[model samples]
Target chain A: MSTTEAGGRIAIEVTVNGTRHRREVEPRLLLVQLLREDLRLTGTHIGCDTTYCGACTVIVDGEPVKSCTMLAVQADGAEILTVEGLARDGELHPLQRAFSENHGLQCGYCTPGMLMSAHALLARNPDPDRKQIRKGIQGNLCRCTGYHNIIAAIDAAAAAMREGK
Target chain B: MYPAPFRYHRAATVEEAIARLVEIGEGARALAGGQTLLVWLKMRFDEPTDLVDIGRLPGLRDIEQEAGRVRIGALATHARIARAPLARQIPIVGDCASGIADNQVRSRGTIGGSLAAGDPSCDWPVLLTTLDAEVHCRGPSGTRTLPADGFVQDLYATRLEHGELVTGVSFALPGKGSAGAYVGFKRCAPAFPTSSVGVQLTLNGDDCTEARIALGSAGLTTIRAKAAEAELRGRTLGAGVIAKAAAAAAAAAEPVADQRGSPAFKRSLIDALVKRGVEVARRRARGETVEVSHEYY
Candidate 1:
């Protein structure tokens, strides 16, 4: 939980998806590294290590944050959700299915971050308009310029989710 | 990108954080949301040996409205502030908070961290200066309050001492007949504004009784356009007078040429932003709902 002092390394516990993990980590470790390397949750891709690109976006304690800019030590005792946690029981989540149907991705480098961002947005506002959807995913940049399809997929997911599909 | 190795100390209280900073000397830095600090660390811009984790400091993330003033705790995230009831009551606060960076960054960036970073391009300093907010800081010695206008001494510098931390910021609520707007021009959601303006006007019918204008990304520090404010005070907010005030604000700015724009280009942006800010503030003062924010092209 809360650490006062621990020399070069510190003990941290975090709940990711539905699993709890405990590890002793160097404070310099980035959260992206924790997810991709330590936990082997490779679904969260790292595009620009800088904060500008939201390729490493994840939901931490209910809000979307850029994992590239967050330290693993900073995420102590928090709940995290990555792209790997989206599907359930071998069934694709509504957003994932919508993305497939709407041709929401091209190179797919930005898919995970876009999915998480759109998921957070839909969680807050189940019926975001086109402009709102655009604002919701503004942090995520797709190099393939597949934003049009991505927005449509988010819209489709919202509608399907609202109808209990 | 891995940050250089640093010892992490989680402070349980404000006094403890200050003590750790004091003990660790200049090599210690206080970490909050880490939206800016971590980026700097990753870039190897500044390598500190110790970090005081103040992210979980109690009673430092509260947003409370008291009597005639609103107080925002240092750890209040931009996302939280953007949706707070206070922001709805004060449109300028919402404009600044909601228009900063993007969703992911806003979800993690704190108002205090933005102010503490002392970046001229940061929106909180400009908006707080327009509201005449006071920064509350606690240090090893004692506590003090500083005006937001002069809090940032220069580029990436602040009045905060080695062992001091900002506890919160408070500003008197704008009285009736007063409203303000924060407007900026940026290339995209994540990019910093090329130039931004914050204008708070107290309008009595058509006559402007008082005006406060602060320019961001137009100088090394947030610049208070006193000459422009002088032009607006006690004058009818006619088109000609507003233009003159905008011109004065453009003249007051000292923007450096960077990838954002040329000096002349930024000056022109400052002029146009001031006018837009004034116009939106005027409309909002008249009880009309005007949605204004950083305009991106």
Candidate 2:
């Protein structure tokens, strides 16, 4: 067990939103911290800091995971997708557009996690029902209690995605 | 809420994992999905000096049927197990696997980690106990197997020693007319069940030839209610008989009052869950597609 100074840093290489990065991080540095603090990708919010809140949710190697509970070292050699990756070529993804059109966000604290989880869900299930959408985002919590609109947004996004939008 | 700094070691094989755990000594913890361990680490519940990452160990994630039994590798995530062909063959497996935590947690949480945590509220231990599963382990002494019925010895404690790691779990395939159900009640998807029941039965028409009843979140460890099971074995599963068995199961529970409910409340909840579980198992045994899971309010 080496101290932070004595143990030094472990090197890791990961791809985020189609970009690759190689950095040295402490063994205890959480994946969320690496994404937000080290990589300057502040779109991945940390709510609750515990695994329960799910605000730190991100897709790692095709699985939606609570980044707060995962160590940066554990995510080495993995591909990560965060909230910042939701847009392309300055155009909002269908999910983002649908969320705005459906009033899916209020205080916006839980929006990032909801978007990532929904993105993963839609990727796996191109057309999800209301029940499936609810189950998909059950890990994320919105303090504003605006889940109905979020579900609607996901539903709309699924429809658009199926139409090849 | 950051976990304290610790040395991290990634082991490519189970043998290497065991060796590193032993070398790192008592202050080392095996990291699986980190769905449970990382939470405790953040809370400073048990600060270990080293974490042996075993999440990427190959061959430990395989779930396959062999001969007369189904073997689930320790690293199989809950989400994977929930939709596996095995889960379709055994609906109880899907019921338990899909009802744990939420989608994100299920994607990372492993059956091995759930059982290793030894938490009474974890659904795997109770579900495995009902299926008469055997936990396989490997350590400095090579390998060994233990029955799931009493694998969890106490709260947050198990029969596992310092260097031992659960490699997998296997259970005999349920014969014809045999089925089981896991039923629980919780406040939300992420919350642990207040009280849950797993009921497995082999029935010939209305007569129950065999029964295994287990209660979770009802005691310090998952309780195998043999007395409750006796009330059903070799008996016609009438409403009256099921009520008696449910009552017996409830009486066997030693629930401690917490924010979930009072001890009396948990007993009543257990009784209801046992009845529901038995009914679901019976329906499934009759070739009915009945969906049962952790009811969230």
Candidate 3:
């Protein structure tokens, strides 16, 4: 029997992008599925469902993690950040604007995950150098743009955030 | 892919988690930094009936120094260790933790889980083996300490008993003028290491006072390069000495071929990593702030 039928969906409550949400979710339900399917916040992409690809990256409790690999139940009581929540007052996050201006993306399939990872990176390291930027987003992969633009975008975003832009 | 259907239980304490594991019977696993375990579940490599969520347990994820040794809690993430203050005492911890996988993996993978999972390709077990670290495990029967040297018995196997949880890992703080390095060969940014060498050396004016060499991804379990250690200790470290030690490490390593690399290729990597690890460690012993960023590409 499935866990839901045998017992019931586990009760989990999480604050996502400053919004409190409570739901009954399957213990097996991945966090990526909850965000993309249940919440209809499809910004998080899943290029490779395996641990790699970094296309399903999101921030849980202020740290970026692979949403596809993490179970929904594990996210209980945590604050999650998704690409859908990157903007405030209709203003794009510095990273979002930077990516757009610097051509940090090509196909953009990995944009959301890259943005999330970059957000977390900038949060921890506001003024990371090129080496640190390369290391910061090492988890993320961009099949297009050759990653130079992504690195430049993140670097520019860091500078913008530092100068209060 | 989705994880196979399994019930989840939350525990606030180690004792409670162990009790629940015993009550729930076998096929139950404690969840700590589910970086590897979740992947295993999604791949159907594991089918546990119960998953006791101990990720929120109190005081399990700390990096602290106690009684002349650094005690690392089970839940201490690689990211935490990579940036922890205790890295000053044990640089190898940060050296290895900083390069385990990628940011997401480092943000979630726990030191305890890595050691418990005992994947030969994992970082901590091999590095810990070099530091002579101790794994503190708590179970229903009682608590016991296992040396990292033999904690991993086989591939993906550990000496942990049923219902036992790795509480923390502790190791004696390296003394003054001590430095170490962990060098491993990976195909790219997100692949398991093919072969690695972790070296800890205490030098007294170019004469090696003590040396510990641990090889990873070279065999079923991380192997201690005893002959290599012997070659370094009590000897003046020079090109000749390092060459002999690297040769010893390569001789002791027994690599298996897979997609990561061939046996011959891994053996060559064994020699190269050992040599690089020793050089980096030597520079560190000389009070140079050197970070060995070896790239395969």
Candidate 4:
């Protein structure tokens, strides 16, 4: 039990948004901090930072996980997908477009978390009903919208995703 | 909310993990699923000198059937347990897994961690206690098994010794005509249950042949409502009988006043909750498939 500062820096290789980045980070560095600070992929927000809020939600090994609740070293050699990876070729993803069209966001603090959560839901269940949509994003707390439009956006996105729009 | 400095060691094997834990002694904590441990680290409430990352230890994530038992490896995530065929075969496990926090949390929270964390209000420890499951562990000495009831001693306390790793859990497969239900009341969907009841019983016609009743968020740890179970066993499950059993359970629990509810309120809630749990289990035991999913998970 040496009380030295986080032992020593360790090398880790993580593939984020289809690109691999290798860097040395402190053992205590959280995955969300690594994404936001070292890799500059700040889309993964850290609210509550204790995992009560899903603001730091990201896909690791094809599962949605709160990045704030994971160590950067734990994610070494793992593939991660953050909110920043939602769109491809400069076009907004269907969920992002649906959120905008349906007025799903107001203050936008929780939208990243909502988006990432909904993205994973749609990935697992492409056409979730309203009940399922609510269940899917229930972890992501949106203090602004009252969740009516967020639910509508996810519902609409489910339909569009099913229609291949 | 950044975690304080600590060395991390990813152990590829449980033996190596045990050795590292022994070397690091009390200063070492095993990192599994990183759901609860990471929270402690971020809050700086836990300052372990080293974390043995056992999240990827080989053969620790399988869910399979072994003879008359269903073996769920230590690393099996809640999501995996929820969707596993083994859980569906014993629906109570799936019901419990499906209602733990949310999908994201389920994807990260492991069954072993859930049981090892020993949260008094957590679904797995309480529900597994009712189902009479076993928790397997590996330490410097060797592998061992413990009943779920004794595995969790108190809130945030477990029977796990130093340098010990939970290898997996095995539960006796519920025999035919067996059914179970876990009913919980929460302020919000994602919130931990204020008063929850787990009832597993086997029915012969309308009579309860066997019964195991567990109540959570009602006391220090998940408690067995022995009086309640005794009231139901060998008795014909009528509305009156269920109500009496519910009352017995209410009288058996000792819920403290908390933000969730008042002591009296929780006791009253458990009365109705136990009734609902019994009714659902009765229905399932009668070969009725009742589809239920919580809003949060």
Return the candidate ranking by DockQ, descending.
1, 4, 2, 3
Ten contiguous residues with the weakest lDDT in model 1 chain B: B1-10
Worst 10 residues of 1 chain A by lDDT: A1-10
Clashing pairs in 2: none
Q: Could you tell me every candidate's TM-score relative to the true structure?
A: 0.98, 0.98, 0.96, 0.96
**Top DockQ model:** 1
Give native contacts recovered, as a fraction, per prediction: 0.73, 0.53, 0.56, 0.62
Instruction: Provide C-alpha RMSD values for all models, in order.
Output: 1.3, 1.6, 2.0, 2.1
Best lDDT among the predictions, by candidate number: 1
In order, what lDDT does every prediction score?
A: 0.93, 0.92, 0.87, 0.84
Write candidate 2's Cα lDDT for B117-156 as tens digits: 9999998999999999999999899899999999999999
Q: Which digits, one per residue and each the tens of the lDDT, describe model 3 over residues B136-211? A: 9999999999999989999988999889999999998888878899888787666788787899999987899899
Winning candidate number (TM-score): 1
Stretches off by above 4 angstroms in model 3 are: A1-7, B293-296
lDDT value for model 4: 0.84
Backbone Cα, N, C clashes tallied per candidate: 0, 0, 0, 0
Q: Specify the CAPRI tier of model 3.
A: medium
lDDT of 1 by residue, A79-139 (tens): 9999999999989999999999999999899999999999999999999999999999989
Q: For candidate 3, lDDT tens digit of each residue in A39-96?
A: 8889999888888889999999889899988888889889999998999999999999
